[model samples]
Target: MKNKFSEESIDFIKDHINDDPAEIMLQSRKFPELPMRDIVVQIASRQKAKNKLPEWFGNYELILPPKQNLEQASSEITAKFKARFVEGDSLVDLTGGTGVDTCYLSRKMGSTVYVEPSEELCAVSKHNFEVLGANIEVQNSTAEEILNHNLVQSDWIFIDPSRRDNAENRVYALEDCVPNVIVLEERLLNSAKNVLIKASPMLDIKKTLQQFSSCYKVQIVAVDNEVRELLLYLRKDNDEEADIEAWNISDKREEELFSFKYSYEESCGFDIEEPQKYLYEPNAALMKAGAYKLIASKFGIQKLHPNTHLYTSDELIESFPGKKLVIKEVLSPAKKEIKKRVKNGTANVIVRNFPMGANEIKKKIGLKDGGEEFMIFCETEAVGLRAIWCERV
Candidate 1:
């Protein structure tokens, strides 16, 4: 239902919920309507731990993300969406959660309308927008409701349809989902020239494209080494002629491909040459593009080895967004070799393309975690090798 809690109460509840949500969860169930009461109720409802501040905060842990999970509606999405925003056009972000994307567009667009359904979220967005001094209109309504309330003939419309995290949940296309992105695209684009939709990177990207028209571009964003988000760009014409381009984005650089994974892979067997003194690793995005050979040739760098995804040169190349590893010393993964390489008792350790765990490998060499030196136990295209005293290359 609509919100009954005041703006301050909602903020406090949400903050407590997200931060130490266990508390709020138990507290909320006790007093369902009162946000403050609900906090303690929800927390107590679950289970109680005899705890205090510092230790409670220390309860945080790490969880490995699935490959390409949440790749949609992340920093990459905001950056790319912001890149498209210009000075005069009006922009609308229909599902304005946290208003991250809306804040981005408001910076460049002449005007922006952020339509968020929940009053709590609307309050939050309004507060943030004010702090940023952004010229954005905040509406407490959903995308469907906003269409009825305002004549928002925006130049751009962004819709990030939520995907159930369960990969096997079985949503096949826009027509099958809630708010049906494909159907929504048709309606929104009728008024706006461009519409951007963010979808699960885990979903069958190809199937989604097949169900939608006027899709001009698709972007896969990889953070650090993990692929986290995906975005689809569509146009108003329902034009079948619009090019379907795939872009891979990483902090290093962005690479675009005309085709997709299967076709690109089938086209060629990678050709690898010996790595020069300077080695370039492809950024996360270009790697996702799967246009291995195309990007290598287009960028004018030689691949390190056929199986290896590294490029190298005698000359320093700053253009390639990947790490530049300067290979100083290489040794075997055996205890004797490792000890010899790190004989001076200084090295960092990394296990890559190796069956052994990092701790096992480090223990084998009597190497500890913190030091100025770096050690990487990785299998490169050239073959298996252990590197010590190597920096980010």
Candidate 2:
């Protein structure tokens, strides 16, 4: 059933808004006339949107979808990031579940179409778009059906396929997703000059590139040190190698970006050195972009190891894309050595490419986790395993 909020229900929701949603749900019996489930969903969704989508969350009339759609939907930050790549008279977003991307991207074009197969979601999106002052047409149709309808050509087309199956199990292969983009690639290219595809950040880039004959660029996006989404830009006639963009959209006001060519990363060689005066860890976006060697060569920094992504430089580079820290000391992972190196028997622990996990390492070394001091465990070609102790700069 479509979610509709009455004046009384809306008032009740506002009155009982609490930080503890589960505790509030116990009082659902008080409002039997209202869709208590949907009300709770709205309260929870708006609470999350307050931090994740501040712009849309501020509107009193803003409507939200169920928990599943809200969970899968893009944040305002990433939605606007995708919008910057498109500018034209018209664009169409296929597989527009909650229309989060469609809403933000539509602001860039003169005319836009939001097509979704779910009538309930389309209705909610239409109402919210009206509240946001976005002029757009909403269509209820599958991506494949719309592409085959002899539709009018548009400047750009967007697709974000459902990554889950009927049983709610996750699927990562392009062919496995609903309205499979890989199967409809030819039709999509024929329908527009540019096609933008969004996929799970966990999807392998190199393997995905092998699916298409050519691509314009691949954008690896992350927020607050967690990888979020991978955006693929496709052009019908473009035969050039794909350029990679690594964006750390951690801050709402500013973002850090690094771009590189895949060929440069493949052909170039990098130098590896022992622990230097400072250590640099590439952001989640750059690490997912797989530009390990390029980061070292382009920034004139030395890599600790070919396998380890951590970088080192004698001179400090504050503009580095990721976390930077002063190297206090390098020691062995042995319990005796760690106990002697760490002061106060406490520090923050991070384990990467190591056999032991953070908790296990902490326990083995007789240290508690949490302090200004940081301990990192990683593998190196010179040394099989080593521990780096430092403080954030």
Candidate 3:
């Protein structure tokens, strides 16, 4: 690992901010002493961080990891979201990948410890945290080793296990993840009053709750419309049903929070009816929470089908937490009918629980995939699968 950063190498990286890595490598033939791969990786890492980690990306002195590691790091927005849950004097972050979560969350606590296995990453995190004016203790040790060693009891323990295994295999189960938060959940709770875990967005929430019954709250956080991470907050004595929160962060307005208990969603009843004037689709965070029925019942909207997870209402609900479309026509997915409706030969196609996928339907209907027109293909209790044509609101 390239842990040492020299003045000349830093200058070279700054000079070729926009240069292609291949071209830089070819040009590196002249200067064999410089670390070409490290410099190129820094440039690529900063480029990726531009959109995801704006604060670090804009700073020239901050050292960043490779693109893959940078991708694993949490965005400043998501980190701040996790920070809000932490209220304590001390926090110990085990498996601190890039220290993004540690840096943002440490601001709330007086004493924070960041534990990382990679020596190079620990060095980089120390430098970046220093540059950002955060006073966090960086430790170059594995989580297991630290927990087994002279570990002090902290108020909160945050662990974000590596999603990839030693063989670089992708793992989804909590037990499969590095440090195995599921196996160590009870141990962590013993060390701290609360244990907060940052899990993969793809990790099943229901399965996680089943594994860690002590979870008091499960937060599915999304930025704009994309689901990013699933944060699980666990306490030692949480025996009741956990509260589920779906948070969609937006810059235009305050964070849209849709909270409901899992039992409430399971026990809720929804109405199924024909397409109405307005059709609503739940946001990614809501979908991740599996609060399908609760959303429909709470919004007073009718569901297209039990499995469709799409809602419709006669009156426009301006405060809906997702995409709202005005229905223009509801027709069968017949090729002739679709062709007749899409005279412009271009439309945005969406397929859900339909026999023919979006691409197949697009090809069969002979329409290019670009337009203001929206073609929704979904199943209904009354009709198996039909196409609802609409305009985005």
Candidate 4:
């Protein structure tokens, strides 16, 4: 770890804890004896941690990693979500950068080991883990070195490969990532009974499954309707059709979860109909999972069009894993007709399976953004195109 902060520097940081980091740097000339750079980094990291890692933000003694490492670290919410999959006496984190995941995953296991290639990060993590009272062993080594040397064995192994290449350019493919999970798949499966690999949210799920034959499950996780991470679970000797699950974690409402098999979605059938009393839109997680046909089949709802993902029904399905809106009136896509129904001249506009974009339709219809009202533009099988006026249920 870097040298301990002097007593004078600590006092300065406490006095200006809430000050802007840029402003502090501007006034650094006043404190010639204090470590302004370190103090500013701590204050700035604390600001980011207020929401990302509330528990760590509350602890003053714990040291935060550098900005880049913190950016790559998983938030407390996602780390806790990963902890639910821990089901063994021993766990090993092969690419423990900031140790956010290692700290949480260690809570469920009797023995845990954290391995990292960067000595600086390993030192910071070892210090922080000690301060947090987490019972984890820190190993300053790469995943390949650990595996080749047979240094440790665990029932479960969790790895989140670095997404950036040597040039600091982001890469999403399984083979392009650091340590290349594809090349180490056989060794990983042999090392542990179950292996959990965290991949980029932008990764193509179908393509990734084709790369790993042992993978039996894929999880697409979203927070408050925004997709965040894609997780792949592999078993030692299983090769069944992978089960895909979409999980949306939200603070406003309960979690929305939908799971399906690839074969089932391909064979499922859905009904196409015109607008009804209520309309439903799938969340980001479900959309990323491609649960279009199975969602309608499972919920007993009708699709607006074969290509459109929006659904409708005569009655509200309170349990639907998406937004539920009540259709007030269906207006023609004419400016005059829209003006008649939307007197307020402002609405939350959404477009799907339509030729025009949201901004284009908004400008053409002369409407501003934001309001309790929603305007849904789409192409339906029954009608060529229409604007749906709705209110949140």
Candidate 5:
């Protein structure tokens, strides 16, 4: 909320508004209390144009910036929350963002009080609740503010903090954070008997369980084989261990494989190789969770290279968590090798973790936009390979 930004920085942001308008929009909406000029400068400093917002920003069109990672809040997190809380009980959401979590709790909880710091989001949440016809009350204040206001009584208090870049922020163990277990035990825990905490998946699950054993359930969620959300569910005075389990969800297609499509399971096992000319990389959530080898081995797909998570096979596989490819031809780096293939000049290009981006690849390959055919260029642990998509095979 400070005004450390300068006028020069403000002008720079305005100049790029036509191209980087999304950045100005996202930050401005998230921190609405700040002046427009100051917000532009802050966005410039934080992002520095190194990364533009995701093209798939449509998901957040009606929601606010989440303190927790929004992209990670797939069904994995939603399902877990529903399973933990019963209906007709009061729960306090300490850090509500976009109010999506609250939306899921709609059918289960009797009443919910959201504690948020962003004034911008408070107004938005009101609109969302009205639109969805929800009766939950939201307080546009921080957890500390609400606590100071003597508003800490609840059956369950939930927390989903921000820790994408800052590890220290995620270090709130048993005794830290808003109304820690110790504080809860003295006050609300006896009355309400529930406290749910969400932390980053990067945290040590064993350590978290050992320190917070009083709570009965500790849930770790991984969407599409990638760890997205870590949930700790507690009931007052309850003592037990959560049955640790793992699951993968795919909205597109689901399938199982017995062996590697090319390399036998007994032959390659879980080993990875270098990048190949033609490679297939899974979707984002999968990549983030480091389930690269698991997917490859599970689907009987071989990696083009170990360094790259891209997969390759002679036949197409259904039900994998990525695009099915029909690799037509492998192009050599030599312009001459590509010249003959370029004669047709009609196909889409699929680039998987390639040095050159999708546009760069398309430009270099002389392919037109929205073509029926596709070419895959990718690297892996062992080597790089190239191929054309035959079909979803």
Candidate 6:
């Protein structure tokens, strides 16, 4: 990557940094000497980074990748969370696309090597690393090439496989991902004492663990209640059942963490009862980890139904790992009953183990989307389907 854009182009980008990209493109004819298209890309990418990558957005010298790569790159919040696992003297990033993970991990290690097959991405990452003052070596080669040639050895290795196929379709299976960690598991373990793999949140955790011989831990990470990534941690000779951890990074920058042994959830027993005074719904991370029974047992709350994940308690459990709502009333799902109980024609609707979807129920009940109250629809063992009105605690 030679300096394709000149100093004038840089000044132009800085001058119109906050301008609309589409508007900038329409005014391209006025600025004939500047690289308007490239400048517009940088401006647009910077706008997208405003919230996701605040640190990078603050630094004008950093060269961000294209919109697609930026979208695939981990947010700064998640990158910082993943960096806590970094250990030892040296680290190797096997698939360093935009180098966001590598840049954060590099701060914790004595030395770091970033490997990516794309020459363009490698160049851009190398430039960004220099601008950010990160001590990293950029390798323009594939992970397989580096491992096969025995190019480098390190204490820890991290890889986030490409989740897209040649046709640009998204894939969720571990075997379907590029570099196919399933095939390279043995070699990766042989090269490093610990291997960390970032996977799609949609991947089945149990099936993914069965594909690996050394996986010892699995992390389901969510940001602001939305499940984001699934991490598989592998040790050289570990054979224990993988420990499962669910992390919900709240908007307040606090972590709502719950961890359990993979086998414990299957053996746990829970009590089934009707809706009580309060209702609890597990966060996205816990739901993705399949902790339905374990959560009820751990929290000492009764479940509404065997299949329904909603829980209830007579006493308020402030330490529950999810939303806590106080039940105002339990009424039939009939429109007339709901209308009589709920004077306001608006509520936040949530459905669990119910026949109709949330939108369908909302339409049937003639309710709008937003309000101070929540209408939770679920089935209990005693009463088949009931609508529980609640307010956030």
Highest TM-score, which number? Answer: 6
Better of 3 and 6 by lDDT: 6
Q: Write the per-residue lDDT of candidate 2 for residues 266-381, one digit (tens) a residue.
A: 99889999888999999999999989998898889998888889989999998899989888988888888878877589888887788889988877777787767888899876
Per-residue lDDT of candidate 6, residues 210-297 (tens digit)? 7885989999999999998899999888979899999999558568999998779989999998888999999999999999999999
For candidate 3, the 10 contiguous residues with the lowest summed lDDT are 143-152
Clashes of each: 31, 0, 0, 0, 48, 0
Candidate number with the higher TM-score (1 or 5)? 1
* lDDT against true structure, model 3: 0.87
Ranking 1 against 4 by TM-score, winner: 4
Off by over 4 Å in 5: 1-88, 97-100, 117-132, 147-156, 160-280, 314-316, 342-346, 352-355, 380-393
Query: What lDDT tens digits, residue by residue, belong to model 4 across residues 113-132?
Result: 99998888888888889888
Error of 3 at 359 (Å): 2.5
lDDT of 1: 0.58
Instruction: Write the residue-wise lDDT of candidate 5 on 152-186 in tens digits.
Output: 67767766654433344544444554435445443
Report every candidate's CA lDDT. 0.58, 0.86, 0.87, 0.89, 0.54, 0.89
Ranking by TM-score: 6, 4, 3, 2, 1, 5
Candidate 3 per-residue lDDT, tens place, 72-99, comes to: 7899889988888897899999988889
Would you give me the overall lDDT of model 5?
0.54
Off by over 4 Å in 1: 1-88, 127-133, 145-152, 164-178, 200-213, 221-228, 238-270, 274-276, 343-389
TM-scores, in order shown?
0.63, 0.94, 0.94, 0.95, 0.51, 0.96
Q: Kindly report which residue stretches of model 6 are placed more than 4 angstroms away from their true locations once superposed.
A: 1-8, 251-253
C-alpha RMSD by candidate, in order: 8.4, 1.9, 1.9, 1.7, 10.2, 1.6
